[model samples]
Target chain A: MTTDTYQAVQASNINKRSTRWAEFLIQSGLGLCALVSIITTIAIIIILGKEGFSFFQHVSPAEFFLGTRWVPLLEPQSFGVLPLVWGTLLVTFGAAVIAIPIGLASAIYLSEYASDRVRSIVKPILELLAGIPTVVYGFFALTFITPLLKGIFPDIQVFNALSGAIVVGIMVLPMIATLSDNALSAVPQTLRQGAYALGATSYEVTTQVVVPAGLSGVMASFLLAISRAIGETMAVTLAAGATPNISLTFFESIQTMTAYIVQISLGDAPAGGIAYQTLFVVAGLLFVITLILNVLSQKILMRYQEVYD
Target chain B: MSTPNKPAFQLDYGDLKRRHRKAKIFANFCATITWMGVALLAVLLAQVSIDGFKWLDWQFISSFPSRFPAKAGIASALVGTLWLISLIAIISIPIGVATALYLEEFNSKNRLNRLIELNISNLAGVPSIVYGIIGLAVFVRQLGLERSLLSGALTMSLLILPIIIIASREAIKTVPMSIRHAAFALGATRWQTTWAHVLPAASPGILTGVILALSRAIGETAPLIMIGGLTYVAFFPEGPMDSFTALPIQIFNWVARPQQEFHELAAGAIIVLLAVLLLMNAAAIVIRHKAEKKFK
Candidate 1:
């Protein structure tokens, strides 16, 4: 070969090597990005676990779980987490009572009754509702919902679980409606037709056939919505009073696990003190609660998901 | 016609009529409940708008927080929000998109890949405040970033990273496999094919996801509150290391005060926050529509 051809071959070899190097670099870069999420999960678990373990060193597990008081700042610093847990459950239950019926009904209507135009309009509106900040909902709860409730029942306090529950219910409504609507719509058209052919009324068909067939999806939506309600912070912090009372009454003031965390964080709790450690302990409990709920919901969603060709 | 006769069993026409009527009423009731939800949304928007418009002026946007409610503005919070969002976008988008690409294109169905997928889904559901604790322990304390804008942004990026990855994966999945085949047939490497063809095709959908995630990040107060976002910053943050306040935190502070005037200011700040969220959502919707049309 001539010298010019030999030089060209060498340049071609160099080009191939550079391309291979670029490919390797890009692949590894992408792999590292994927690893970031795993690293984050590990970091969260380690940090929370380490701090929470330290907290257990100071307080016994039984007292933290079974005690009814949560005054970590005052003298005699009782660390009964039951009050906060009860409060969280009360608000969550209230939210569920308010949200479930309306959300399910909305999902039913959207899936079965709505025209295409109506679905397009109403669906986006629900998305808009979901996008509204929880802080705004908190404001609305304080200014609108609480006063409205007070008008109906004069015994209601200015800051009560009912108002917080109602507002949170509203916040979680979109999630339930959207998810359940997808579930409902996912049922095969042939199933609905089969019911109709058997002289089933539209309502009968929906309630008896469609909903049962899509039960897992609807249940998954409910679980996800419940999880959302449990994890919600700002709305509850504002509307539910900061006093950690273990009351079951809807009209009473209560402090949820999230609200307690917020109160301590905003306050002048010295770092590494009991007051600060309680933050992690309660947060750990909150994390466990939500994580279990989320994992359970994911399991239901995956296991019972109906497939159609 | 004469051959028509009643069946062996009675039809019970009255019972049938009653059942039909009940069904009709129940259907109407469901529709009414759905509309009630829409009405609630309208009432919420109206109340906030009415309370907030008076305070939403150029002066309010330009000035800083003051002891007097009437004079107070969201300038610092707004700037802080902008800074935090920009930093989050800078940090999260590339990582999220790359992770999405790896999951969709590089990885095959395996135990590790399935675990990664499960991890991402679980991360998406983790409470935002839990993310704050992580930020506090790791970024703020361990890394010594303090309660600064950088720390807050890093925390938020983690919170929303899962959401972005999920959305990006969805977008990537929409790109047909034939496109990949064509690229391969043309002697393109996997990375080159994904980078040049697949990404361009999926860009609009990915853009939608980014905007939606940013909208979520902007309204987040809990994690930021956990990371010690200042509620009373009077001046804009000069750098990522400086302390800052965000729109939601400022609103939360103002609303918590007992004064009615501060509540009004809170409403005003909410309007500003809502407007930003609305704009971002609208952009996402528009882009999604365009993407749908192009792909179709």
Candidate 2:
């Protein structure tokens, strides 16, 4: 009996020690997995900064920022970033204009009025729209939307900002609607009840109470959508013409920053050459723009995040 | 004489009724707008179907891409996409799951944990193109992986990692605390309890997230473009080291050409892509529903 008890105790102790070691090993392994994202962020900065900074050495920041032309392959290469920035802004603006009203209204309807059954069906369909590839959207823009626009306005170019903007707008509609719907739904039910109790109609309650309460989240959604629009590449690349023209007309073709990167990548730009380095510089700018928007949106989202127990 | 003086802005029943009517109309209008968005999507799908249906055949699926749109097939792109997605799944799933496990189960609510959380959310929001750039620099050039299928897959893995991690964390959170406590009372080690019980329970949800992420990765074009995915490849990739084109890249190339036949081919490819996405999404939804029922 004594021998059996001793053996049992020894086995238990061994098991405990083994468990401890396993726990340590697994924890550290998982912890390392979590570090990969941080490492990626660092890698982006290092890669883009190293090459981007190098581009600045060849072309002053002033000329890069303030110049009006972007012909890197030509003899007198000008790297002015304004035209690309303007194209991005135009597309973003147009998308916002098209998406905001429809998207917000959809959010209001989905959150406030739709039956649970309708919501379940509509929600997945919206998600499907969101899940459709951007490249598919590019094809749709080029084949469907552009032609339709040209039919309506015969003067419109085949590759125009309007087509890209409209497609991107549709692409972002789900984002805005989903986020704003979440925001609207997160508004305390008691507030809506209170408004209703005060003889306010359902619309009044939704518009006056829920919308105001969720305004910050809605705003954040818009900002995030705009950021997404700015960064959008494939659809814009296919629909918007690759000319870096500094035009204000939506019907005319223009090259976006992302399109410029694609153009450079597709061409045979020698590794580490100025043409190659230009891609990094543009990428850095794109990174900065998106990072700023994301940070701002996060701040807005957090600041207005309502807590309920 | 008996009533007190009326308030300066007394409620008017007629005006209130009118306002209510207006509000109802506006609400209906909003609902109509919502349906319009759905209608737009329907139209898009219909248009693609009409254009692409004739070209979507067994022959289209088996043949290699050719200069002539009538002779071209998506076989190379399809095979390449499959290889890329498989490699991406292999590379990303373990890391993503582990990250979620660490964040949800191991880390205390400390500064480092908070920082990690922030980093993940930021990464999730980072543009896919930026990831492509990182892939070009780190994987393709710096590590000399070249513009091969492996490099593209690795890039895509990074792009979708944050999404998988977030979804996995959510799944883990859904697992009840009681299960953990019960396992602990039975003297099971933390890793044993988690690996044996919690992970199994969370697997369905994790799988759903993974499927969704893969769907997104499959549709992605920009990052792959930045990673130098070939626009045209006549042969299927033999291995991870071989250069390959994805469906999206192929579609983009076709759509860019002025040839009407190529545009039709692009439409056909879109149909195939969309069909795959739909199937995956349906599977995910079914799995999620099953999981919810099981947990309940």
Candidate 3:
């Protein structure tokens, strides 16, 4: 009887041990999987920094960041980067102007006024627009928007910033609209009723009460849209010509930082070459700028959520 | 109803009429702009159909890229996109789901968990081209994967990981705590409870998210270009390590050409790309609306 009891106890211990082992293995396995994102972030910084530092060793930061000209691929190659930065700002702000007001209005309509059927139809259609690839937008800019712009401005170049800005605006409009809609709808229903009780019309209630309460989210959406505009590559690359001019007119051909990266990517810049290193440096700058904007947007959005909750 | 010489809250019919008129005008304004957006989308689709329909045929789908516009097809690009997407889904989903599981089930509130969550949001905001830079340095050059399908797939996989993980976690979070508690009460280990109950309950939502993320990867262009997927690949990629071209790259090449016929070719390829995207989205909707109702 003692011997039987000892054997049974041994078997139970073995069973318990393997089950515990399996549970431990699964938990750590998941933890390892989660680490991949951390690794990606580290890889981005290390690779960009190493390559960017290599480029900075040859070129001064002042010249790279503050110079006026940016012809990095030609004779008398210059790397001022000012022109590309200027080009990006012009296109990005231009898109902001187009997307913001319309996106806000659409959000108000969808959240405060639309019938359920209308909301159902409009939301999916907006999503479908959002899902279209950037390259297709690029094509539309080249074929449709550029021509339309040229018809109005006789002196406009074939590859003008105007078309690029317009298409990028269209590309980001859905995002702004959707995010702002969520924020607007999240406002307590009692606020709207209070405004109505005070003898306000539907438009007044929406504008005065709903919009103000959802302002944080709207602002966050704007920041996120701006961040996306800055990083947008393909549509601007195809629509705006590769001429890195320091001009603001939508009529002139301008090249963005993203387009410059795309241009180099298409060429056979030997790996480890200075030209190749320039890509990483520019990307690093782009990454940092967008990262700051995104983090700010997220913080604002979270704080806004906390206020409601 | 007020005493003489005393100011009272008076309803001015004229001002009220003006305000109501203004409200009506503004409402019409919003409706017009919203419809205008829909109209713009319609124009885009119609324009693509007009430009592409004549060029799209059986031959266009079957033949590979060529100097002649009529002879050119998306045979290689179609195949390459299929290969990249399948590989990306395989590589990203398990890790993304596991990461979600770890965050939601194993450890809910901790410094490390918060860091992981923050890291993912930042990664999502990192521009796709920035991801391309990393892909070029690590996958193509450092790992010596070259400009192969594997490099492109890995790059796209990293690009979409944040999306998938975020979606998966949101899904997992919705699977009521009672489900887990019941499984535990039945003498199930944490892994068994998670595997048998939590994952099944979340699968519909997770599947929808996965399909949407995969569709996004399919339409991406700049990252693939960075990894040299823009090279002229005349033949179908034979393996993961074989060099390839994708639909967006092919369309970009065609759009860059100064010829009208090539522009039409780009439109034709876009039609194919959009069709694939539409299919994926429809599937997501079916899962979200039909299959997910049970969970609701």
How close is every model to the real structure, measured as TM-score? 0.95, 0.95, 0.95
Ten contiguous residues minimizing lDDT sum, candidate 3 chain A: A6-15
- lDDT tens readout by residue for model 3, A189-236: 987887777788877777777888888899999999999999999999
Clashing pairs in 1: none
Candidate 3: pairs in clash: none
lDDT of 1 by residue, A1-309 (tens): 566865665565445878789888988899899999999989878877888899989899999988888888999889999999998999999899989989999999999998999899999999999988888899999989998999999999889999989999999999999999999999999988877777778878888788887888999989989998999999999999898998869999999999888888887477788887888888888888988999999889889877765
Question: Candidate 2: DockQ?
Answer: 0.54
Model 3: what is its DockQ?
Answer: 0.49
Give the better candidate number (2 or 3) by DockQ.
2
Minimal lDDT window, size 10, model 2 chain A = A5-14
Roughly what TM-score does model 3 have, to 2 decimal places?
A: 0.95
lDDT of 2 by residue, B185-263 (tens): 6666677778989999899999999999999999999999988657778887999999999888889989999888899
The DockQ-based CAPRI class assigned to model 2 is medium
**Which consecutive 10 residues in model 1 chain A have the weakest lDDT in total?**
A6-15
**Model 3 / residue A183 / CA error / Å:** 0.6
Q: Which parts of model 2 are misplaced by more than 4 Å?
A: A1-15, B1-14
Using DockQ as the measure, the top candidate is 2
